[model samples]
Target: MLPPIPVLADYGISPTHGFLPDVLPLTRLPDPYYNKWEAIAANLQALILSKRLRGVVDRLPVLDTIGLEHDAEWRRAYSLLSFMAHGYIWSGDSPSDRLPPSIAVPLLKISEHLEVPPVATYAAVCLWNFKPLFMDEDIDNLENLATLSTFTGAIDESWFYLVSVAMEARGAPIIPLMLTAIAAAREADAATVTRCLHTFAERLDDLTTLLQRMHESCDPKIFYDRIRPFLAGSKNMADAGLPHGVIYEDGSGKEEYRQYSGGSNAQSSLIQFFDIVLGIEHRPTGEKRGRPQEQGEGHAPAPKHNFLLEMRKYMPGPHARFLNHVQSVANIREFVEEHRDDRPLCIAYDACLAMLRALRDKHIAIVTRYIVLPSKEVRTRSRSRSPEAVRRKINLATASRQQPPGIALDTRGDGKKDSLKGTGGTALISFLKQARDETGEPAVEAWAHRFMSRVIRTEGQGDFFAGKPEEGAGLQVASQTEEAVIPGLAASWTVDDDVGGICYY
Candidate 1:
């Protein structure tokens, strides 16, 4: 018999909240001893605004984690220190390379308990940083939710975080739903599995709608210019001024540099769970289609590092374990392939992938509006200014000072902006487009497969290819083009519009 599908409670996952805290996140720590951290978090926006966060944090006395009694308190402490840590690191004229023991010491302890990095993560910013506006209202409703902390204290920042929270809440049902499908698959019950997949596709459509709602409250310009910089991680940020990652000084007089990717939606367990249950695999950035075995003659090649798998390290401990357990028993894809003669089951299975691809398409459009367009504007504005004028604007909070790695303010000889990397240190647009394309790889129907994998072309351009391309040619060529096709989505831009930039949500 297949090993049992993982139980949600065993992994501290909630049936109603998904990866969000089973209990509401503490608004304030009950223990008074850690008030300094709380105070810093409470005043973080003002401190960052006045450029005093670093000095205040430097003068703080290191506090012990003993006062944090419960898991909620531990989570609260983690959220507080994470906000302060990022604020301090990026609050000065340049990103700080060294973290004081006051923040670094307890943060490391809390992170160890949580099995995440000491730096801020998606869990810190979204999962553990939100509260319902009214106790009686649904937390999944965007209007009813509010963020507990933010770097700039702007509605745009809170909106960015809350949208993810709402998604997690709305997507909570998909966990048990897919686990049920897995059990039905084991029993060879196609009807139950089909029903589950239909519901799963509907929930995915709901999520896509929620994602598009990002524009309702959050302004793109504010997000790219003010909030995006604070979310950056030290890894791949040599251009942002920290050649060596931040040094966490623990008062041992011997400190080591630590590198970690910043908070990213890639770290969210909800999205990964969807991929796992649906049996979608993501190869590493720049990897071409094909089996790993094809790379070598009569020998299996070593596995390339998959970015999505790497992101699990950034998720909370129990949540990551939950994904691992679920992966072991995910039978939906296998079952659907086995029963392709069952038309409804195959259609339902393919529908889920279609909705997922649409969600990714929406995300790419949002990234274009928020990160890519604003980056061009910043580049243009900087180009028209004198060197001294640009220099005067290079403060800690200034977004222009820290362009993501591989993104240069100046254009290349081809007059195209350099490619951008996400805060998680992967190629930004290419990574997203590749992931979207990979979502269609498991379609049950040949027609669905062709539709999902078709190369999108401009209005007048001929069809690039009708079906999945040969292992190393078509998709790879499409990825290299300036206007990369988001599989099944058309392109409209020229070569001159080839600027790139990063996004997290």
Candidate 2:
């Protein structure tokens, strides 16, 4: 059985039943396909190509208001979904598309019966990260996902905006993970599955190894329905969240600190999204100090175990164990210090470490308040957000909220300007170069914009979601519409090196 759901009752939603609308559909598909894959694909393609479907989508502004505009990350995310959607569509009609029973049987094992990273990853990003961002965007459609067979908006409409929020919350760390895993899988699944039985056996063996991870997991739904969607960016989102803990005054208004303090600092609240689990402390040398620096854990490596591990009791076992691993080898400061002198190297490697951690921490903190926490309170606030709302918040957070000299998101690839136009990655690198020259305390706006603009990247056909709205179009993904996949996350804090970055910034 699944674990008991946490806030479902308070929100008046049930996890055990259909995610449907109050208005009933006049028709129903045969039940088997509704419960499985092949049928749904045929239906989706047929529906999408139909005039009626397009008309219905056009008439429903609520469904399309959150179209994924101005983001490449969102575009890539949708592409992955489309890939799966295509797989589902073509498999039944195209014999070659169908997986051999041999592959199917072990895929079940490798994915813990959840299928390829699709359902699990979607559930994680949607529930844990995106829902809070779009909780109040008239997401009645999401509540009625059962009607999607007849609904005609981009498949992303219901969830894309929500994903944006979660992705932003995590500072887009998760997207690379998605790109890494899916690209590798897409590349390898075919190459690794050559027709040889030995190859098949090897694939199965590899899958069996992946299955060892299943015992370590509980239900993805725990994140989807309970803990994840509520991380938001407003006061309500932060009932316990602290967006302004590190504040910077920018003349316009006092803003939440947005400067990159350093990479993955242990002190930032970004590391504490799982505070209950990671047991992150503000202190520099405590029980968590024994291990070497890990990614998500504090930059300083831990020397040995501490009672903070006992605090894991308050967190989900996976989260606690994961933090312990990070706490073990994640201190950027100590790592750089040990590698080089504590004194300034050109960039002051220690500063780089601090900046990286700070960036991660700030991102987590912002995402929680802006995306997750607000999602939990959607019932109370239903007003549509204006274009200025986010921009204003960003400006307020910026040390100089003034727009970049020549970098407006409006010109990106719009064809109005012959220039590269909307390449956010190109622009971020430009800004980083400028900062490298400045050598002064960085501007919050410059760093924030540049940091946020960092393209969610992968080594393959670029961002899988590129051109797809849910993954983002250019570089500026709204927090409500996309999720960055962070792969190899240690769901448990078993204190291992080479694990996922911990709760540290």
- The per-model lDDT (C-alpha) reads 0.78, 0.26
TM-score of each: 0.87, 0.24
User: Candidate 2, which segments miss by more than 4 Å at Cα?
Assistant: 1-38, 41-108, 112-119, 122-335, 338-342, 361-505
Per-residue CA lDDT of candidate 1, range 1-505, in tens? 4567799999889998889988999999988898888888899999999999999998999999988888899999999999999888877767788999889999999999989899889999999999998999888899999999999999999999999999999999999998888898888999999999999999999999999999998997888667877887777555556667799988888899988887778889999888888877787777787863322111112334676778788999899888877877877887887898999999999999999999888887887777666655665676677766666443212334334434334368997655444433356566777899989988989999999999876422334555544566655666565432110011111112332333322
Structure candidate 1, residue pairs in collision: none
lDDT of 2 by residue, 352-430 (tens): 3234334443433333333233332331232244435423322111101222333221244654422111011111112
Number of clashes found in candidate 2:
116
C-alpha-based local distance difference test score of model 2? 0.26
Quote model 1's TM-score.
Answer: 0.87
What is the Cα-based lDDT of residue 206 in candidate 1?
Answer: 96
Model 1 regions more than 4 Å off:
291-304, 393-425, 462-505
